[model samples]
Target: MDTDRAAAVDPIDVEVGFLTPALRSDLLERWNEPQRRYHNETHLRAVLRAVDALEADGEAFDATEVRLAAWLHAAVFDPTESENNERSAVFCERVLDPSAPVEEVARLVRLMGGHRVEVGDLNGAVLSDADLAVLGSDPETYDTYAADVRHEFAHVPGERFVAGRIVALEGLLERKSVYLTRAGRDMWEKQAHANLNRELGLLRAGAAG
Candidate 1:
């Protein structure tokens, strides 16, 4: 499904027995925080849809855990906070049902900090790929995503932000493969590389100038 269409749907629509109405409202409110330019409910929906898309493409994973992770991945987004992932993970562990794979869900949420997943980690693979799926979006969408990220960090000085952004982009480029799953590779690998390279070049050039 397209990001726009997927993002338009409320994340509460995704069926999960563990997610009570009160909890869902709290999570949705976290995502809708005014400071969030990109890590909002829309991004959460896109990630959930991406998980479904990957599964539909035959990627094996634990759906309930992955979707839970997806919902809580950016649940504590604060552009100024370096520990959002850890905070998010802690929050996930605190609020999830006792029977839920709370540890697994928290692990997946923490993985978002770097998108690094070890081989054979099916749940991690799915969640990581879904979170990074935006990197492979079509040019216009990717551009918008990039702009939104900058806006989220608008308080940073241009030089510092560009320097930091360059580091982040290069880290992704240096990954053996930006996407972890077979389906993720087939769907977005090449486009993700292209998008990263294009953006990296522009940032480097701007820095040099």
Candidate 2:
């Protein structure tokens, strides 16, 4: 309920600032698609807010490129499609302002699909950390996010969902550090780990039951 439930994407949605009105509308419509739950406009706003938080924390980055990446990271979301990021990057590259450093944003959005920012790429670090901020939300918020994500993938059978979700969660846990930026790590590392472990535990219990 973060946005008006039936809010239409105005061609000038400004959510996609700098893009032509038509491209802005298209991007917003993608975020507003009925199929989405967690990856909706609300999630888009949250990630943008995280970008702002990063700036407030004094994190150095190519601000324009990072924010541009944030806006388009989930532009072509398809829970069932592994190539959504690549697709999203293509769409972004096609529509982004010619002077906006397309290659950098494309790289950030592509790597962001897995939250795997390249080491020392501060722009990527900011975008990746912003994308993962939800992982460190409080239990109530985290639970809500988890449920919304499940709903988004409701097409998957329950067992498959559990299995796929476990592999994904464990993959994140296996990472040496889930958040790359120092601020991100300082703020989210421990809590994010706890949240992932807790969810994995619940999924296992459900599988056992």
Question: What's the lDDT for all of these models?
Answer: 0.89, 0.83
lDDT of 2 by residue, 1-209 (tens): 22332233331233443656676668779999888999998898778777776776679998878877887888998888779889999988988888778998899889977776667889988898999999988888899999999999898999999999999999999988888888888888899999999999999999999
Task: For residues 114-165, write the lDDT of model 1, one tens digit per residue.
Answer: 8778889999999999999999989998999999999999999999999999
Per-candidate TM-scores read 0.93, 0.88
Residue pairs with backbone overlap in model 1: none
Residue pairs clashing in model 2 are none
The 10 consecutive residues of candidate 2 with the worst lDDT sum are: 5-14
lDDT over C-alpha atoms for residue 188 of model 1: 96
lDDT of 1 at 131: 92
